[model samples]
Target: MSFVVAVDGPSGSGKSSTARGVADRLGFAYLDTGAMYRAVTWALLQRGVDTADAAAVAATVGEVRIDSGTDPLAPTIAADGIDVAGPIRSDEVVRHVSPVSAVPQVRTRLVDLQRRVIVGTDAPGIVVEGRDIGTVVATDAPLKVFLVADPQARAERRAAEEGGSDTAATAASLQRRDRIDSTRAASPLAKADDAVEIDSTHLSLDEVIGRIVSLVEERR
Candidate 1:
């Protein structure tokens, strides 16, 4: 029996980190659903597929093969056997991911792959983190969490993670992604009606992890 925790949130929110912690604490496999999409976007760019061309995306997509480990520090993302660990996070790839992720065809393909990965093993459960895990891909998950923080705080978190990238530039890019993600018609980043919403602006990392762990422990 698979028990999945679907964590959805905007960029720079604590979803990814928090989910990884929960997964580690509970011996659940963690899935970075966003990276899967980013890898696809990076692959399409390498093939020169037009981001705006749905048909082109559909055609070249079968060439992409991706996998992610539950260990957040060692999380590996590859396309066609190539470790795209570097290119997947390049500015170009990040810029195009929202649009690529917006395509219904792209979501359908990636979502299927994600489900397969989550259920492929005999593991007890999974901690899945993404923009729409709760509302779209893993709506039936036993625990659904929606993480949100002040936009400025989110931007600051992203800037620090960039490791010397100009704060203003990275923040601008993040803002653009947020707008695109929020406005997209297909399974946009949103809080599901039944999800537990957590405002993480002031919470320490350990604090957030502890709270989610308690929530799961109490429920299970």
Candidate 2:
């Protein structure tokens, strides 16, 4: 049986990295849903749409197309035929993505697209990570994991990974993202009731991956 894993977590949590690592070890496809939202947000920003206007924001959903690879090691995304693989993760997109993603129309479009990717892919299964994967997009996924960490540890980890910012600012940024993501109207960041919550604050990356592997094997 194909094993789809739904991983959901708040900003600065180790969801992205841990999901990618788990996918690599299990030979499963990795779906970065956050990048998709960021890419769409970037497209709307490029077009000069007012960030606060829901109708305006939703109008551009058709113009932006997100394409990602199934490979765990290689991640990619594009917006409006433009290769935004790198820029989507920039500070600009990061700041506004929550507002854009919060729009009802925007979420509707992206969620449909995400479902297509998960169902259409040839990979045996996909490990999807985002704010609402377990709650919305892949609710029926057999393996659901909600990764979390202390706010301080999350900030430190984010700061260390980001090459362009100081730890203090990175911490502040993550705090802002957490507020935005959790407060958004559409499929806000939440842990599923059945999801296994893992506190990765003090755990090593290997430890996290091993735990997920154990979960997967048990399911198998």
Worst 10 residues of 2 by lDDT: 159-168
lDDT score of residue 17 within candidate 2: 86
Supply the global lDDT for candidate 2: 0.85
TM-score of each: 0.94, 0.95
Over 38-128, each residue of candidate 2 has an lDDT whose tens digit, in order, gives: 8888888888988778888877678777787767898777777788988887888887887898898888888899888899878777899
Taking the tens digit of each residue's C-alpha lDDT, what string does model 1 give over 93-160?
Answer: 88888888888878888889888877784668788999888998888888898998887788888878
Clashes of each: 0, 0
- lDDT of residue 174 for candidate 1: 77
How much is 182 displaced in model 2, in angstroms? 1.5
TM-score of 1: 0.94
Highest-TM-score candidate: 2
